[model samples]
Target: MLKPEDFRRSIVHEPGEFLAILERRLRAAGSSGRAGPRARLLEKLSTCYQLVDGELSKAEAFLKKIVEQGGFYAELFKLEAGVEPGEVLKRVKALRRAAGNIYASSRSELKSARGERDAREAFRAGVGRLVSIYRRNRKTLSAVRRVALEFSRMPDVEGDLRVIIAGMPQAGKSTLISRLTNAKPEIGFYPFTTKNIIAGHLPVEPYGRIVLIDTPGILDRPMRERNPVEHRAVLAVKHLADALLFLIDPSPGKYYSLDEQLNVYRTVQNMLQGKPLKIVLNKADATPPGELEEACERVRREAGVEPLVISALTGLNLDALKNWLTGLLKTGTRGF
Candidate 1:
């Protein structure tokens, strides 16, 4: 299986790098052979041909795993259906076949040459053939380059338990993650500050490790209206989360009204598809007592679950919330 991090390490060479690697191998082979001069040249060319074909094979295998194993990249690949995956595969195979034929034809010419000058000319012709092969496949190489960059930006979330923080914009999801773990996601006072899914880890002794995910704010609107970045956040919530912490901002002057925030809550609840969830009322220190009580009552009435109140900024009631999470982990309960 391909984890999200695998994409970063996978090699997607540029045309120059690919050709340079083959050229270096060819030169090394030509210089290292102990056989006669003619045999040495043939050996070098054959080795260079094998090196080029081998790299293509490796690239093909890597792409196949990324597309077929089914992870974040697989989903993205499916979305880019217009850029047929088969086309990339076909180009790779064709490039390899053309390279093999060039090598074979060059080898025949080298053998048929009557003198040293003729053999040297054949060798130069072989190098030209290799260059022509690369030129013909330039577009295919560009496609691979584009795909590699797309996959490299994906977040790597790996652990035994995945806890995703989801809420409307400016709901303190990032702050909560910063406080809970050592991971420091960029913090801002504005909406949609977190544009991607950032992950952190909480090591709870005697229980186990918990991977905490901080996702971009999900607006209360139709899914089709959301941009690609927001859609990626939705994908994290839908596919990556084991449990969700839906944070609610009840401060009087918050960006979204209480009802609007709750609307997003309902939207997220539906998106979770029965995943475990906990509604947390964040920024309690900023909310007035009367308004806080009303918010709590509203959540209880609408969500039918008692919400946890904690100020991520001031650390109020955080210990209690942590204990609650520990208890949940200990009991293996799905919902609170």
Candidate 2:
């Protein structure tokens, strides 16, 4: 997993603001040193070049990691930023290279200068060129900051077993994960409350850890028609889920019809591609027994899989669901 916390903590400032701070540091360093005027000027110029190179190098390294990791970070940058991580990395590297070339050319000129004045002029010109490069790529630098901040908000899923709880709007997926694990996702009586991937953990002794992910509500639509929130669920199902728990709301007040929910299920099933999928019928407490049985029969007839009935609200048959999860995970067998 590409942990967002691994990103650099250095605050990326606006180019002008960064230059101002660097000038202040140079002034203070010069005032505190006991060197001649020419020596002080050259020393500050050297320090300025090093500072610019270091900052650009750090940003380039972080962007490279995001590209190389190519898991959640890469997908997220592509989906949200509308650009690939590698593309952004290229821009950063270009800025660094431009600055490095300026500094190298200036250093060569300084070595061949006839006097201190010429050397000072060349060094100052190089410093100004580096600052120009930084200022010209303000948008690129801001993108680095935006990526770091966005990734910081991502959920952490550092567990052994990764299970995605997926379903239509108001399907009680969030409620069920909250009931089963310590994660308390924002629950509401509406659609699409989970706009991002929320993770909950349950440790099963020596058997290892189980990570339950609650995904945003997915409507039955084409991938191009899906919103960013729904697309995030699709991405998680594709990349992160080791197993899936598809929750179906069969109550009278369900948001989407059984046919619609099944359509979404088929999409997720395609993403799973034979991964372990546990179909769970939620809101059993609110549903009539006859209607619930009919829904179960419908699911079995259409999806060709039996579903476990449980009420996420009233904790009906929840213990059984937990036991099944633990047993199946422990033995690598699929049965209730």
Candidate 3:
């Protein structure tokens, strides 16, 4: 499974640096044939081969993810190739084959060699072949490196219930996510505080986990006006959200007017295509009593659903919200 931390470590560089790192790891993996029985040496050799296979397999998986789930990266790949999604797969296969050839050659040499010295020589030859393959496929490896880095910026969310916290800039989505889950997304007062999707998890007993995603703050404007990062956020809402908490700012100094916020909500609602959603009136603590009432009435009249009122900053009514969500999960309502 892809965990949040995987994003930090998944990017593999070009074959040159990658091979060097693998070589160091292999050397530190201990002598496969250190002054032991022949069987022991063979066992070590097998383990080493498995290690190489495993690492290459992981690299291949990363490439596949870039091609499949990297969003903009996948689009770029398609535009560059003018083909379907199999180009990266082809490159991954070629890289795997090169690594496999080294392992096969090394295993064969070890089987035929007479002594420990010869076995060690065979292993050295295998590492040399790995370096040679990397150098020969420098171009492909370079492309892989670039794609890996590009894709690493996108968050990987995993859980039973995927809940997206989305709203206009400064809508308290980040604060609410931090309060509801274990993720501490950067909290800022400025617009576009969050430029990418940030993921967190809420563990509810007997109901498994809920993956909470804090998406980038989107403006109340046409989709064409949004940047690529905001576009990715919209795509996440469309594709990843099993449920959504669409936050509406009702504060007097809110960046966008209540009507503009509602328009953005409608845009997201349309994008979601009937996925479960909760229209949350955030910043309730700061909103005036009359203004909050007006906003509530307007939301109900406009959306035909009563908006949930809560102050994410003050933790007001948050427990009740949690209980309500828990009930939804238990009943499997709204396809939770």
Candidate 4:
């Protein structure tokens, strides 16, 4: 029962050791000689891992051999660890793009609706596109936009401001979501605890509605396959964020390493792709005073963007964070 953690720990500094692990897994997974296309592909990937850091010529030769054999792993291996840069680019060009066209068109339609084109039909069509656009990209950003758009159309939920609580898994995402909104998300101690997206509302004054999103944590562990959940959750924030409450944990185990935390943050940041990104440091109670300053410094250096600090466990800074979230939604700036 070897896990990805084993491979990551073993290969942190040595590619050779990593290759050995891959070979052993491939063999154990019944991807041996003369296997099915899938198996053969896995076997080829094993070989690619073995050859990754060797001389460029040697790497090129190994990859060419895999292409000759042909299998699923051939494409995956080539894109991820292919020896030749040109080959990698060729593979990338051929790869099926994710979340294509639908959202882009919706974006254009939204702009058209906002401009002098203020046709009632245009506004109706603009928000209608959200249903199609966001069903696949469920997250706070998407959820908020959908809610806002639909709310505008309907008489019921209009004026609901988006208050997003975003962070990696186990970073108090659910706790904050529950505290801010009426939505209840499954809270757990493990990584990637929430598997589904949960929506709730915040009770504010005047217009007084808040969109609270409880999203599954983005696991930062070594990935054997692309995380579609992570992709969807990230895309939600990227395309749909109004205001973000990003959480950071300075605990031991996987996420404590600033590199790992930053890596997950970058994925979310890339998903946001220039959307307003705010930072919040979670788990201050868990962060010992001795490590607090150092951890904050690490977060400042590595987190994709900067955010405020709050302790979901002790309710420390939660009020301030909430007020900031409210003010941001109301005034279009979180008192920045």
lDDT of each: 0.78, 0.84, 0.75, 0.51
In candidate 4, what are the lDDT values of residues 184-259, reduced to their tens digit?
A: 6778878777664566777777746767666666656654554745544553464345556667777554244666
Q: TM-score for each prediction? A: 0.81, 0.90, 0.70, 0.48
Per-residue C-alpha lDDT of model 3 across residues 1-336, encoded as one tens digit per residue: 344355446555566566666666655554555646444545555555665556456657765765666554455444333444466578668877877877777778877888878877876676667556557766655565555565566566767778888998899999999999899899997998887779988889988778889999877889878876677678778767888889999999899998889899999999888878899999999999999999999999999999899999999989987886776667664354
The candidate maximizing TM-score is 2
Worst 10 residues of 1 by lDDT: 77-86
Write candidate 2's Cα lDDT for 218-283 as tens digits: 999899999999989998998888889999999999999999999999999999878888899999
**Per TM-score, what order, best first?**
2, 1, 3, 4
Our tally of clashes for model 4 stands at: 5
RMSD of each: 3.6, 2.8, 6.1, 23.5
Task: Show the colliding residue pairs in model 4.
Answer: 141-240, 238-272, 279-307, 279-308, 280-307
TM-score, model 3 to reference: 0.70
Cα deviation of 184, candidate 3, in Å: 1.2
Candidate rank order under lDDT = 2, 1, 3, 4
C-alpha-based local distance difference test score of model 2: 0.84
Which predicted model would earn the best lDDT? 2
Q: Distance (Å) between predicted and true CA of 245, model 2?
A: 0.7
Summarize candidate 1's per-residue lDDT along 148-173 as a digit string, tens digits: 66666655566657788999889999
Q: How close is candidate 1 to the true structure, as a TM-score?
A: 0.81
In model 2, which regions exceed 4 Å deviation?
Answer: 8-11, 14-17, 108-123, 332-336
Of candidates 4 and 3, the better by lDDT: 3
Badly placed stretches (over 4 Å) of model 3 are 4-10, 15-58, 65-85, 94-143, 146-156, 333-336
Tell me the lDDT of model 2 at 121.
Answer: 90
On a 0 to 100 scale, what is the lDDT of residue 188 in model 2?
Answer: 93
